[model samples]
Target: MIQGFVKTPEVQALLDRASGKTVEGGDDRLKAITRDLVESLMATIVKYDVTESEFWSSIKFFQDGAREFGLIVPGLGLEHFMDLYMDAKDKEAGQSGGTPRTIEGPLYVEGAPLVEGDVDLSDDPDETGTLYMTGQIKGPEGESPDGAILHVWHANSQGFYSHFDPTGAQTPFNNRRRIKIGSDGRYSFHSKMPNGYSVPPGGSTETLLKAIGRHGNRPAHVHFFVEAPGYRALTTQINFGDDPFAKDDFAFATREGLLPVPQRQGDSAYVAFDFELQRSASSDDEVFSARSRAAA
Candidate 1:
């Protein structure tokens, strides 16, 4: 038995064991995906001749990335990939809707206070310009879906989100609320127009972006999840049209359909956008979502 250099042969052996794993009678799908990911990763390492030092450095980066996983996906365009996949799936299933879907970054809390028909997300003086968003909840059939629920949240003017920022745990529901759709499928909310958020400064996320010559700044936007009885739950965001970075978001979450068309009503900024949900074949298709899974 002879051990040569720690470069190629040794790395190949390590990768083979790491990526090649067989679990007798395990879930075939999970096993297959794991093998695929492992093999691809191993191939990349071999193909690029990644050194031990580089491999360890990457391990550290990934460790840090896990903490900021929510920011990582959007920064790396993985979120958009999923959106595209879902879009394709919907199309394959013969489902079409005019409203485009976007990423629901990993910051949504399981539950928020449900309001009657309208909600005021914040009243803090430090919060920026007032925003009044009104929209209708339409089903895949283009009819108003009565009693749909819209879960809405946004960052503060300073771009701090509850449950993810300092003192966020103290006021976990700040700038967050849920509104029940009316019989006519109308819903509204009053909140401060939240500015965009950025990846934590000088953190692992930032380091990764910097290495790739990228900045981690998402444009001003608000997150929403609409749920109806028989319609698919929609996770989306509405970007401020006037924001300079609206189209250049680091998360790449902004879409034209979801952009807020500002309508000045006195001192407030009002935007009207309709949410159309695809009709789900089964309740499981729509009822189970990030919101519900988080709750569970």
Candidate 2:
């Protein structure tokens, strides 16, 4: 037999265990999922013609990524899984449709400019594009929530973000601002029209996409992180309806009701949307503070 390092006892033991399991109902389901995962892993190994060193290097990459997965799952769109589960639980509890929630994205920098009332978010009007977003924050039964705070951010026209962009002098944290709602729970801001941007061409995200022959384009959208005293913290994005890639976001974040209609006027446009927050019987103050810290 041709001896390969992979034929070691450890792998053999795993294979033996996998074979010995007599798959039942739940086991059958698990096997199906495991098969997909294992097949994908094997396909990747073969496609790259990965060597032992390269294989281990990729493993380390995944290990590091796994460590960050907790943060990424919430910030990078996978929180949709929790949303799905929550929807099911809500339906079982007779809760109907409410404002849709979405991924917050990875660019939210804390300590953003805070405005108790509506204000212009385009601090650098010329450098940053122009966008006028208007919306309301409602509680159950469409009632306005008092003192709801809206934290928002977006990418620049060049698709470069603040802190991530090498040209930091032009825009420190491109398109990041926090606007608080008034007693009426209504809010609006004026900013530039952000453009669609891709991930770094040679980074891990790009590398995986390229290997899979997938494009790394994200549709033009705004990020929102909303927090109110007694409501659950909501992290979401609003995709511009006209964006060609809006429905085909590489991040896979587009949701049924998350896309907003944008009406163009003069050189810019207005995007109107509303978010309904779920109120918990027990206060979520601690949860909100923890989320704020994580964003910080």
Candidate 3:
């Protein structure tokens, strides 16, 4: 009998059972991740002479990583898979027109200030840059989806989002809102154009990106989450016409149809856009989305 370490057949059997049960997600990807994780652990076990402290430390590290993984696939661009699937569905259903969809970032809170077709969101005296966003929410048949709601948000001119910036003032909990589309399916808003920004330099996401020598920079853009009864909620952004980061956004959220066409109009330049919605008979609940619910 071994003195400190257990060597009994019962202990060996328990270890085997535990190892076999580590992956239970039933999804193919989960199984693959489990296989890779176990292989990685086995390599470390062989390298460091397999001790309780080393094994537990590695387990804790992985547990933290898993805990921080928000369920939103858009956070990692897996939502691109969803985009492709939805595109196929649209074509199959003969749904045509409106705006193509894109990824919604995690910073959108909820319940942003509601206004008519336009609003001034800057609310800062020194806020530089002008943004006039004009668009329409229309059905696939090109009919106005009157009263459709547009929930919008964006980074400040400095690229700092509310709630996330400790040094900066916090806006309402959700930098989001419900806007009623006009009879012509048109909507618009006013805010300072946002600047590009990096992810916090050393968070888990940044650490991994820098390890691969990748730069973290999301382009200047306005985020929108549009919903109309019968239409699928569209989570997307409109890229600033001339932002250098538009093509090289770290999040890869910029889409071909999402770049707003800049138009000079007197004292202000306007970004014109038009969005098409999938039609159906559903309530606002089916269409409207808060931040938590959107990510969930």
Candidate 4:
């Protein structure tokens, strides 16, 4: 017999393991998913005549990217891919007319201060240009829903998120908050216009981008998460109209309806945006609201 490293047996074994096509024959769902993936990957390897060295080098790149993998996911549009799949499923289920879901970037911090209407989020009093954000949560039937929890956060002017940005470590949970909806499903907050952030320099996330000749910059935006008893929780973001990169977002997260016209009110922006939630039809739909983080 040829060595274990020989190509034919190794390839067949890989396909069997990935497709779960052994005599054991277990887990139909997993096998179906893995079979497609392994088959496509094998086709690419064969068609491109990828060398062993090149394959392992790419694997090493991913291993290094794992250090800051969260930062890399959105850039690759994988996060948005999840949103697209969800949107398609919702459409198939006749679930329509809610705030379009967007990528929930990886910087959400659990347990921010829970407050009532209108709390200032600026860490510095001297922070300029306040943002007055107000919105109501409407149910799938288009009626206001009570007792919805809204979690919101964004980067500061310097393009860094607290707890994630090294320079922002001291400001853990800075500019982040959780607000409870009132009886009318109305919620509001006071904040400075959060600026956009760029991928960290010298990090694997940026290194991958640079290698591909792409700029890794996200436009200024605010993230929102909401969950109600009978409605699906929603996670979305809105981009500032004037951000240079707003229209050319590297992450492909923007939707036409998401950009709101900013009204100026004495060095502050007054934004009135509303969210509509879809009625949960299945446990999978309900999980959308409960799970924001990806699995390990």
Candidate 5:
């Protein structure tokens, strides 16, 4: 084993300089986080005795696959970890009992048309498999949250999402909708049954998964962003329990209460589920995060 030198004064000085610890002006939070990150990376390199070639190869992998980082991050469980971390923080702060948050994979597009009451999300005439989903949003005490908005989106039958489908087959906002809930806090939508999909074949996400001896596949699921005036906004999704990948989601988004089995009703599939939202602690909690989202 190579002698570990990351803890030595020489390496410490280098890290401090590299992380801007010696700088006079900068974002303090960023600088501190950077220092910790660089220190950990240096320690890992020393611990693993990583060679220069191996390091550069890893860097080149990221450089080549930068576009797929959104998929890659969730596949690596970083996004799921964020959810888990947030849950723990909430629990520590005495916040409890609500729908579990999960990974909001990087496919959400803003500006979907908002409609009151039940809406039909299926726009393709050629699609045949029909799915009807209905749900109610309630506060922690089982009271309906008045004036809630349910933003929903899902992939098409071919697992291609609108605005990002490489085939150019999907129209704008296909399989996407925003339903307005009244005093009853109920919403519903009808859409085509979405198929489970795998990561882009031979792309960066798939290549990395292959290298790690893992398959990149996600189960059929519907994404939701629910918000109310006095309730904390929720970013969650529900996986079809019957999907083969329901328990083995590559994005690590499958949660215990989020998996709802679909019931067959003649030619269509029906799903009934309910969401519970915690009361907002502040105004900020009543809105979704400010992450960059696609708009069209």
Candidate 6:
């Protein structure tokens, strides 16, 4: 085994310089985080006695897979870990009792047209498998929240999202909408049934999954961003309970309270669910996080 030198003073000086700890006039938080991250990575390299080829190959993998990083992060469970971390933090702060949050999965498009009460989200005349989903937005006390906005999006029957579909067959916001809840707090939408999807074949995500003996598949699910004046903005989604991958999502997004079964109603399927929002403890909690999202 190679002699471990990561904890030596020589390596410590190198890490400090590389992480900007030896420099001035940089963001303190960034410098501190960089220092910790570089230190940990250096320790890992020493522990594993990683070869130069292995280190360069890992860098090349990241460089080549830059575009698929969104999918990769979720597939690797990093995104789900964020939700779990936040949930634990909330519990530690004595806050609890609301719909569970899951991974957003990096497909959300901002600026969907806003509608009041209800709207139809599917417009393709050739589309089949109609789905009608209705839900209410309620406060933690089971009271209807006034002026709640529900932003919803999902994949089409072909397992392709609107803006992200490579076939160019879907119109802008084809299965996306922003609903302003009425006085009754009820929001509903009609759309084609969403189908589960796997990661792109022969792509970076699939390549990594193959190496790790995992499948890059997600279940049929609907994404939502619900917010009200006095309530914390919630980012959650529900997976169809009957889907084969629902219980084994590669994204680790499925949660106990988020599996909603669909009922057959005539030629269409119906899903009834409710979102319970926690009261916002701060103004920041009332708005969605400033994450980068596609706008169209």
Q: Give each prediction's root-mean-square deviation over alpha carbons.
A: 4.0, 6.9, 7.1, 4.0, 1.2, 1.3
**Tens digits of per-residue lDDT for model 2 on 1-296?**
23343356765456445644444445655665675566566556656667899988878766756634433344345666766776788789876655776665556677777776666665554554478888789988888876678888877777766656656644554477777788888888877778888776656666566776777788888888888877767777888878999888877778989888689876687888999888754664314434333333
lDDT of 6 by residue, 145-210 (tens): 888999999999889999999898999988899998988888889888888999999989999999
Q: Rate the local accuracy (lDDT) of all candidates.
A: 0.77, 0.70, 0.66, 0.78, 0.90, 0.90
- How do these models rank on lDDT, best leading? 5, 6, 4, 1, 2, 3
lDDT for each residue of candidate 5 in 1-296, tens digit (9 for 90 to 100): 54568878888899889988898998889988999999898788888989999999999999999989999999999999999999999989999999999988999999999998679887775466798998789999899988898999999888999999999988898898888898887778888888889999989999999999999999999999999999999999999998999999999999999999999876578999999999998999999988888899
- Stretches off by above 4 angstroms in model 5 are 1-3
Superposed Cα deviation of residue 53, candidate 4 (Å): 2.3
Lowest lDDT 10-mer window, candidate 6?
121-130
Candidate closer to the true structure by lDDT (higher is better), 1 or 2: 1
Query: What is the total number of backbone clashes in candidate 2?
Result: 4
- Ranking of models by TM-score: 5, 6, 1, 4, 2, 3
Q: Model 3 off-target regions past 4 Å? A: 1-75, 89-96, 173-175, 261-269, 281-296
Candidate 4 lDDT trough over 10 residues, lowest sum: 287-296
State how far residue 213 of model 1 sits from its true place (Å): 0.5
Runs of candidate 4 with Cα error greater than 4 angstroms are: 1-13, 23-26, 124-127, 265-267, 282-284, 287-296
| Residue range with the least summed lDDT across 10 consecutive positions in model 3 | 67-76
The lDDT leader among the candidates is 5
**290 Cα displacement, candidate 5 (Å):** 2.1
Candidate 2 clashing pairs, residues 3+ apart or interchain: 129-192, 130-192, 130-193, 131-191
Worst 10 residues of 2 by lDDT: 285-294
Q: How far is candidate 3 from the true structure (C-alpha RMSD, Å)?
A: 7.1
Whose TM-score is higher: candidate 1's or candidate 5's? 5
